[model samples]
Target: MVVEKNAPLQPCNTFGIAARAQTLVRVRSVDDLLAVLADPELAPAPKFVLGGGSNIILTGDVKPVVLKMEIKGLRLVEETPKAWIVEAGAGEVWHDAVAWTLAHGYPGLENLALIPGTVGASPVQNIGAYGVELQDRFESLDAIDLATGQSFSLDAAQCGFGYRDSVFKHAPSEAQDGSGLPRGMGLAGRAVITHVRFRLPKPWKPVLGYLDLERRRAEAGVEHPSAEQIFDWICDIRRAKLPDPAVVGNAGSFFKNPTVSPDQCADIIAREPKIVHYPMPDGSIKLAAGWLIDACGWKGKSIGKAGVYEKQALVLVNRGRGAESVTGGEVMTLAKAIQTSVYERFGIRLEPEPVVV
Candidate 1:
């Protein structure tokens, strides 16, 4: 494992923020990770596992040893009459992996196309789009324990999938005896996901429950759309709605769509009749975060070099370029302003989606 000191980080993250890693190691394979752990100089150091860097906001120069996961491989692990199992390395680009699966005739992952980040980070965030989530297609994943340097595997249940959350999002809690055994469910910084496997069911069926997909189907004049058609529609819709990170530096959605109880929804609706919301399967009301921000007059507004996207109020963008780029503090200030305004107006708190490092 080659360790580089003060490695440049701007190119790694989707936000294009300027930052540096104190010590960075590019993990091209599992052996490289093991080697790093075995080394006396690096073994005890706190580490950060970085994938595609799409879902993170670098607050400043990272102090932890950055394990830049660059492992790359994709293959069909198994095929049965009921399903097809495909595996990908941690570093495989999530969008490319979805497209690869579809190209190989695996249809279940088409709904998740164009999501940023890597396969390794998908489960951690429970990344979803359209009407499907990563949990719906996830089979299992392999990870190495950073603390113990031991590799392990887990299924969906063990991952503890939730809306935009998973075990990886929480810190490990203390055991009753304080022996470091995690209580309840939280993996967080304890593990590094090395690979992910997806289970695509046989006899593919399209998931077109989302409004945009339905509208696309209507516009195309097709009663039943193929997987490829749905894929194309999703890509087109996302491209039109969200800015390409390559052109404009920003994470896709800045905040989660806050959910409220039925009574809470009624109360909010009584106050603001035009508030946008959707009924979830669990009987909760999911509020549109963008609507809340826009209602607060944040759209197209700027604070220093951080600005709210004019097209979609849900996204926050960097108004500056390169060296003049928006700092993490500016982004957080804008985010906090929006959150406080939304909470004061709607009596609901908005949570950020990206991990701030």
Candidate 2:
């Protein structure tokens, strides 16, 4: 493992923010990670882990040893008639995993295709798209405890997964009686996720939850498409709708589709009638933030070099003079403006989906 000082981070993060890490460590395996953690010279300094850097915004230079997880591999642990347990290294790209699953006929993750970031970072945010979340197929994950340098595993229930949160995202403040202080750990520092296991169904029917996909299936004169067809369609739709991050700088949906109470949705519906809402299992309604923002006329609006993408109201694009010129402050300004506009329009505040560092 080699530690570099003042490392340029613009290339690492998908946001294309020009920032530097005080110390950047690239570890290829578990032993490599432990070797750095055990170094006497680097003990007390703060540490932060960087996966694919697809879901984070670098505001400024980060202080600490930015440990970039480079561990990589994919293998099938167990397989049955219904499901297959597959393990992926933390450093493996999420899209690669989805592609591999689709190639092997695994069904659940096909809907989540084209999502950016690393497999290790998926469970931390419980990443969901096109009606599929990581928790839906998550078997368990092994994380290295930074303090003790020991490995631990967590099942779905123990992960404390919510809409877009997990125990790794939000750590406890104090010690609990029987619960043992909730570990006081989150996705950032205390625990570094090294590997993730997913239980994907092999012999399964397709999930046609999203309206657009359902419409496409109907257009093709097929009520139920096969898994491979659905996967291909999803990839096509994503490529059409979302800006390719490789060509443009983006972190998927900048803001999450805010969920409101059923009564609130009903009230809004009474006023606007045409406002669309998806009823959640808990009775809360998931209001489309894109529609709200478009109604407020924020789509394609630009501030400095950063602006909402003309094609996707939810995606904030970097169209400034140069990639390095774009700043987090500018992005935050635009996000806050959109949030304020939506609040004034419908009494709902929009929250960002990506982790803003």
Candidate 3:
């Protein structure tokens, strides 16, 4: 457990925000984490667990003791006739893990390829793209209780997965039993995910219902696409649609596509017939947030050093470089402005996807 003071965090986060971790510790293994907790001076302090830093915004210097997860490993834990169980360390790059699984002949994670962040952060947001979400492939995960230093595992149902939501996103309340466990459904700051296991079912099939993917399939003139082909197509599609964070410094989609009732969708459609919306399986409509922001004339617009991505209005970018990069305040300001505009125009509140710290 190596602890560094005033550690620079610009390189750690995908958004390239200039910030520092007041007290930072690199946790490469479960033993490192246990050591931190056993330390007399550091054990009592508040801590923040950081993964790939793709889904977070740093407002200022982080005050909590930063526990940067760097645990690394990937292995086939179990193999049965029905499915292959693959396990990944919390520190492994998410896209690389997905590619590794594909390269090793496991095929279910193809649709989730090219997504930013680490494997540990996937279930936290129920990260999804195209026709599949993390919940669709998740088997179970091992996490440690920050309060008690006791470890536990959870299956998919125990995760309480909703659209881009899970128990990990909520803060624990004061309704704990004698065991210091949360009574209701919250884990927010009390758990540190260590490893994630994915169950890739046998007899793989390509998930290609998304319009872009369908077009790719039609263009290629292939009725039955292989998992590798779908993976390549998704990569190409994402490359065309989203600016690489290495070049444009962004946190993928800035907002979650808001869901509305059928009546609400009908009302909005009456006012704006060209609104982009999709009918979900549960009788709800998912509006395209990019379309809403673009409709409000916000694309290619900037508020200070923070700007809306020109190619995708749903993304927020940092226009400045290095130390002069956009501050978290600037990013939030632009996000709020967009949210207010969208809400006033469509009567729907847009929710941001990234965690604001």
* TM-score top scorer: 3
For model 3, residues 152-254, the per-residue Cα lDDT tens digits are 8999998999999999999987798876667667999898999999999997877878889999999999999999999999999999988898998899999
Give lDDT tens digits, candidate 2, residues 83-155.
9999999999998998887787566788888888999899998998777889999999998867667777899
Worst 10 residues of 2 by lDDT: 179-188
Better of 2 and 3 by TM-score: 3
| Clash-forming residue pairs, model 2 | 168-187, 176-181, 305-320
Positional deviation of 74 in candidate 1, in angstroms? 0.8
lDDT of 1 by residue, 120-182 (tens): 899999999888999999999998888777788889998999999999999987662343336
Least lDDT summed over 10 consecutive residues: which range in candidate 3? Answer: 176-185
C-alpha displacement of 142 in model 3, angstroms? 0.3
Query: Each candidate's root-mean-square deviation in Å?
Result: 1.7, 2.0, 1.0
lDDT for 249 (candidate 2): 85
Q: Which runs of model 1 end up more than 4 angstroms from their true locations?
A: 176-183
Candidate 3 lDDT at 283 equals 99
Residue-level error in angstroms, candidate 2, position 60: 0.6
The count of residue-pair clashes in candidate 2 stands at 3
lDDT score of residue 161 within candidate 2: 87
**In model 1, which residue pairs have backbone atoms overlapping below 3 Å?**
none
Q: Which stretches of candidate 3 lie over 4 Å from their true place?
A: 177-179
